[model samples]
Target chain A: MKIYIHTKFQESIYQQFRDGLEPKYEVIFGDGEVSESLKEQFLTCDICYGNVPLDWLNTSSQLKWLQLNSTGLDPYQQLTEYQFQLTNLKGFFGQSVAETTLAGILAVYRRIDELTRLQTKNEWVGTPIRETLHLLHKAKVVILGSGAIGLKTKQLLSGFECKTTVLNSKTISQLADYLPTTDILIATLPETKETIGLINKTYLDMLKPSALFVNVGRGSAVDESALIEILKEEKILGAVLDVTEIEPLPTESPLWNLPNVLLTQHSSGGWAEESAEKVVFFLNNLAHFEKGEELVNNVDLVKGY
Target chain B: MKIYIHTKFQESIYQQFRDGLEPKYEVIFGDGEVSESLKEQFLTCDICYGNVPLDWLNTSSQLKWLQLNSTGLDPYQQLTEYQFQLTNLKGFFGQSVAETTLAGILAVYRRIDELTRLQTKNEWVGTPIRETLHLLHKAKVVILGSGAIGLKTKQLLSGFECKTTVLNSKTISQLADYLPTTDILIATLPETKETIGLINKTYLDMLKPSALFVNVGRGSAVDESALIEILKEEKILGAVLDVTEIEPLPTESPLWNLPNVLLTQHSSGGWAEESAEKVVFFLNNLAHFEKGEELVNNVDLVKGY
Candidate 1:
């Protein structure tokens, strides 16, 4: 079977992936860009790993499976139908994403951002800054979406002894009540019909003035304009946005210059060995595919997980 | 009995402290400075709630007890003799200090410092920066000292699934064995005769090239010159120094301009309600003092914890 690997991995990682496959199977690697040659390779491959173009997959006849390197299925949601089996790296990112979420929140609470700024100027604020700092210990936290990321975030927050309440579709209605008392509000929701605009001005306004807002999930889940307004007015303490309304967040956007805003540029699900790990996951799934067993982390296209 | 609160508390916190005390006991609040009036008050008071001048305490015949606002007893180590029963806030800063240590470590691993720099420039460095990012998960960690800060730091690291080895004075000999394999090295040792300059060039040289060094304990515990050399040469990944050799670390210090070094400026143990909490602790300790009960966190100045 011919396999087209579409993920843009480092040279060493690509070599590792190539070495892991059996000698009998034909394999091709793409430069992670759509072109005539990539389309030709995609058309003949029996299995494809990584996010190949949605339009290319629509017309592909021989592709049996398409494994996504990412956990989010927002891009694939646009596809009306496809014959290929879809699997995503769902649980794989839970630990990494949750870690970044904690890092962001803790950075805010400990005033690491201000300290970093001071370090650059070689200024020593010293004991005076302490009065303005906060502790995550015993803080009341409200987390949105009970998915892997949210669950892992909650688990991590437990170490700080933060009282965490996770709100999902079932418990989302109670978010308003939790927000008023919450010291930290984390959103780990996926992009869905119900999730979009869920954190509107009303919910944002309900948060305590001392509340820290964090979003590690999809940006569509929040009303970005409303969040910006509240942040500008100092209605909420600050925000750690790993995901924003747009990728490569337009330089002109006020978020880049916001006083207490920390923009991670959606790099929360990243690690040094991310590409190599994804390759291993693909190889393991490939073994199950050869045995005619059901693939893991299969996504329901209609539900848009 | 008269109590002289030498701690520089906010006006509100001073009121809280005054309110908590019994009316029969005379109370005087100091402006946290050494003056003729403060010294006169210090000499007359039976109990002192903060770190009064060591010279003044030496001649104070009326002082019966000293409740320090800090965990470290380095300042009192110089006193040759004293009549007062000394107690420090040993376990009080454990939670706050541990949280800051995690925040600083995670900020480095997740590249929050670099991201913050990018944010300032309004630069969206997407995808490429992911390769430079790291995860604290499953990292081999070595923690120096077994004090409240060190133990609390270990407990917090458990949430990240880090394999942590805590080395106190007893197991400090084994530090060399752990350093070679350690991904993160944390020093939470206090300033004592034995602990001074413990993390010198020898132990620092043993660390892995990718190791991250964190010091939240005392500046005296580490050899600043050795740490600076390794960081300058890129022998190790980075460092998070909450306590430096000289703080308000002189303007000429290289630590301020170091690429990956995060200097928290000794603000790790601070919280919004720190002064209030200290007052509450003082009030509680006052009860024990009045009843002739063994005071909590009593420091052995000779041994210097």
Candidate 2:
């Protein structure tokens, strides 16, 4: 069997993959980009590491397995008809992303952004902050998506004494009803057909004026225009968005300057050893595949999570 | 017996106090300020709520009890020789201050301040942030002052799976030994002869280069000049201070401009309903005092916490 490594990683991580797999299989290491040269090698390879364009799925009949480096597999929904088995790094991202979600929530609740503004101008103002201050404790929280992200978020919030209700496939269809009582609504769903644009104006309007909305999931899961309107009117307390409908959110986007919004620039899943962690995840799954055992994070094609 | 309310509060809270204790006792609602007229009334009043000058302790012989609205008893430590009961709102502040301490820690670990700075410039740069990104999970944490504040902080960090060791009077003298392996060091000590200037240069020198030091306790507990020197030299990772030795921190202070420092301007105890909460605490203590029972949160004058 032949394996093609086609992911951008640090030299140390690449060395790890080479040292681990090179002895048993016909291993090929391509410059970690999806260039024309790397595309040619995918034709003869039995297995590949990292994502490829959906078009490549139709041409690569020799490919048996492909491991993705990301948690969200929505983009690959189109290639479900292909013969290759797919796996994603799901559990690895939960801690980093959940911590980011909690950080954003606590930042808004404690008014850290406002304090940072004061710190930069070298001003020490105290009384005005009390008007907008809130506590995460005893909040009625609603977490969408009961996957690793949602479960980890609940466990973390356990210390805060929040009342949490996670909306999975069975419960997500009625999310609008959950918003009226929610003090903090967090979305951690992928960009699946069922989830895309789910948090529309109706649901956003149902939120209490003091409630907070956070999206650590795909931004396509929310209607950005509707969210902006609510934020402009100050209908809701605030928002913390780690992902937006567009990447590198346009310079002119109002989100950058909105006093009520904290945009994290899609860096919620970031960590110091991200590349090394991903390489380790792929290697572990590769070992499972070679042993003909069940892979850990194998994607269910129908769910497209 | 006469009880004087010497704190600013809402009319609703005043009404609540009136409904709670009007027919049996003489209830005087004095202006919030400690004026000459209020001072004269304090001389004959049986009890008072809200902080007064230390000199009032020496002059007011008829004042049987003093109820303070804050947790820190440092300001009143000088009047310990006075023959009156002193009670500070100690346990009540744990939840609010602990949330603030956690907020500061998460902000530093996740670089919320840096992201906010980038958000202001409408920059979407992502790569550089990953180098500084970290999780609160598995951190070696040391919390100073094993009172309500320290214990609550420990409980909150427990969800993050941090290895926490809280240093009270018994263990604080040996804190230097813990610094080398510590990732997060938090001080919640009150101002006392022994604790004052305890986190000086000698202890700071023992910290690992990547360690984070947080002070949500009294500012007088740390030697500000030594902390500033270490911050300037980049000897430690960063600091989050809710209390400073001199507050409304002068504009000329280097802490304002330092990349690693986050100053909260003493808003750690602030919340939306602070006045109402403090009033409720006073009312509860009043009930205890009227029954001739020991008041909750009575200060041990010798230790002055």
Candidate 3:
């Protein structure tokens, strides 16, 4: 069998994946984008991993499955429009992203960046404790999306005794009601047609002045322009953003300079062992595929999760 | 009856306290230091709230009680030298300090300060994820001083599924055994003869290279010079100190320049509503004193915590 590995990972991790497959199958390692040589591999390979061009879905009759390297299915929305099996890397990143979400929120509420700024200047002055210090205990937290990341965030917040309400596609209409009372609004919603630009000015306006907005899922879901304006004017307390509408957030973006906003540069779903973990997951799934067993994390294409 | 309040608070809170106590008692508002005028008031006042000079404890024949505005009994170590009812604010600052501890730990583990530095320079790049990003989940955490702050930190770590062990004075002898394996070591111990300089070179060397040290308790418990050397040399991971040996940690302190150290400037015990809570506690204790009832949070000066 011919398998095409199209994920970007360290050479050692790729070597591990190659060694784990043994001599039974031939493996072609390449980048996510399908070039002419990758196209040749995709045409004859029985399985392809990582992202492929949306238009390349129908290019091969032998392509049996496509596994994604990420949890978000936005890039592969056309999966439903085709007949191939689609599996995503889900459940794995929830812990990493959840940890980042907590890190971001706590960093902001504790005025961590402000202190670091003072440290750089060798200033001994302290932040106005009464005006800045915030306790996470019993806070009203609204987590958007009921997926793995959101649920994990809810579980993590339980220790702080925060009152958390998770909103999914079915109940997102009630978001306006939740915004007014939320002390922390965390968006872990993936980008779909319905979710794009969901956090517009209207939704942002409902939040209290002390409310903190956190986005760890996808950037397309929020209206970044509106958020930037609100942050610039100090309308809300602050934001802890791991995902923005753009990747490598443009150098001139106001979000970078905003004192109240913490930009994590899309590094939330990152850990030292993530590459090794991915290799293990891919190998396990490949073994299952060979045995004719149903693959894990097989997404419902129509639902676009 | 005569009462002296040595802590400064809001005018509205002072008014509330004054109004709560009727014509039966004389109330004197003053500073923590014992000046000539404050000494005169302390001579007559049976109950005083906040700091009093160590030598002046025996000068007041009528002094029956001393109410402290802080949790640490380090400054008033000599309180045991005199015979008087000593009550310090105990459980109140736990949640605030615990929140700060988590914030500091998460910020360090997630490289929040590094990202903030990048943001200041408008750098769109992320820190090397493979070298930095860490999950708080499943981390082996050991908390020292099983008081309200230590216990609360343990409770908060439960949601992250971290293996947390809280050590009090009784079991602190086993600290060497725990330190070697601890991924995160948090100290919430108050200053005492036994605790001062407890985190010396010997104890710090026992920790794993990746271990993070957090001190939210009194600064006297840690040997500042030892910590400074380790931090400067990058021997251990880093430290998150909310309390240092000195307030407004001197401008010349190397901790300000060390990339690994995060100095929160003793703001962990701060929150917007702390003054109100203290006022309520004082008034309640005053009412208890007036009714000849034993006060809550009454400290045994012999134990010095």
Candidate 4:
């Protein structure tokens, strides 16, 4: 049998990955930049070592299993009955994303943006800031998604004596009546057939005026028009968004000009070390599946988690 | 016993205070602006209700206590004698100052000032921002003075999952190590002989590079010269200060132009409603003291807490 690595991986990781499957199969490297003539070698591979390309499934006829490293699996949600088990990298961004959620909440409460603007003008406009909303203690924070990243954010905020309630599509009664009194709303729902455009004007109206809204989840979950209307009408306290429907929010986008909005690059869970780590992790997991072991983070195509 | 409210107080509280104390002693009511002859009523009073400005003591030979509605006892520290017991309002500004510290740290970590400037000029800047330090779960924070205020700051950062440590003149082993590794340092010390110049170059050098610093303490607690020197060299990350050695920070001071500095006005803990709440709490305690009840926050001239 032959194994194909579609992307160039770290030298050390490549060696270890090769060593793991060497006794059973021959491993060869092929980057996306590899010539079409060289691509003919993929036909002989038993396992395809590549992320599902954005275009579509065009794996070689000899390819049996497709392994991935990124946590999100929506891109591969519609896999046909090829009998190939797809696995993905998960839990890698848990702590990283949770930290981002905490940072977003703190940014809104502290008025960091406003204060910094004043600093640039050489104005030391010291004024008493109220501590009434200082701690998340006794606050009702609502999270819309019960996935790994959402659970991690909950765990981080849980120790601060705050009440966290998550809303999932699974119809769990334990989480009902908990959404209305929320003091902060954090969205981590994956975009899918059921979740797209889930947050409407009526949905946002349920929040208290003191509530903070954060979206590290897909931008499709929130209706930009409703958000703009509610924010302009002062329905909520503020919002911190890491993802927008449009990547690289244009300078002309109305969302960029909102005073209460904190617009960040879509870097919700990324760090300097994450890219390299994910690449290495994927290669190792690819080796594990090749050994006929129970693979970690096997994606449930139907759930699209 | 007479109560002098130098500042405007709630009428409902004044009524409650008098009703609570009227049966035990003679109550004379006047504010700090009362005429000298009228204020001389303290001469016959056993306990004069007032804060600093020893005129009440001068008028009342029988004066046995001074109930102050302020938090810090610095103004009255050396200025007052043992002729009367002095009490102050404490724990009132804990949340306010804590919020200030959190705001400052978030401002630095997120590079808020630079982002706002970019927004003003309609420039996108997070690509450079992504290169700076982040507010992920691994932040280590140290707080000087684990008083009510410091504890509140800890509670806020606790939501961020920061590794929090604290230092006080007295022992706090319940907190993290005395001099532990910290990515953020928050100073909430009050103005006193022991606390003056508490933050110096050596204290600053112990902090992690690219760490955030916040000072909600008194102006004198920080060595301005040393702070300026460190900021000049960019050895530290960034700072937000509500207090400074010199008010207005002198237009000529280099701090006004520093890249990562935020100077706020000195009203960090005071709110529009705080003054009234302070008076009510103070008068309630004054009534309790008149009945020989142990004072709630009687100042210890020796400890200077």
Index of the highest-lDDT prediction: 1
Can you tell me the CAPRI class of model 4?
acceptable
Q: Model 4, which residues run further than 4 Å from truth?
A: A1-52, A62-69, A81-85, A128-135, A171-176, A283-287, B8-69, B80-82, B110-117, B125-128, B131-138, B155-163, B170-181, B262-280, B283-287
For each candidate, what is chain B's TM-score?
Answer: 0.97, 0.94, 0.93, 0.81
Please say which candidate is ahead in TM-score: 2 or 4. 2
Residue A113 local lDDT, model 2: 87
lDDT of 3 by residue, A1-305 (tens): 88888877668987897889879789888855558877876788888887777766766778888888888886676654665678899888898889889988888877888888888998866646544678899999999999889999999899899999999999999999889999999999888888889999999988899999999988998999899889888889999999888787888788888889999888888887888888888889888888889999998877775
State candidate 4's DockQ.
0.35
Clashing pairs in 3: none
- Residue pairs clashing, model 2: none
Candidate 3 i-RMS = 1.6
| Model 3 lDDT per residue over B1-305, tens place | 88888877778878877887888889998845658877887788888888777666767778888998887675576654666788899998898889889989989988888888989999877636534678899999999998999999998888899999989889999999998889999999888888889888899978888889999988888989988988888878999999899887888888889999998888888877777778888889988887889998998877765
Q: Candidate 2 chain A — worst ten consecutive residues by lDDT sum?
A: A29-38
lDDT of model 2, residue B145: 94
Candidate 2 displacement at residue B146 in angstroms: 0.5
TM-score of 1: 0.98
lDDT accuracy of residue A96 in candidate 3 = 84
Looking at model 3, residue B155 earns an lDDT score of 85
Q: Candidate 4 — which pairs collide?
A: A125-B265, A126-B264, A126-B265, A128-B267
DockQ for each numbered candidate: 0.86, 0.76, 0.71, 0.35
> Sorted on DockQ, highest at the top, how do the candidates line up?
1, 2, 3, 4
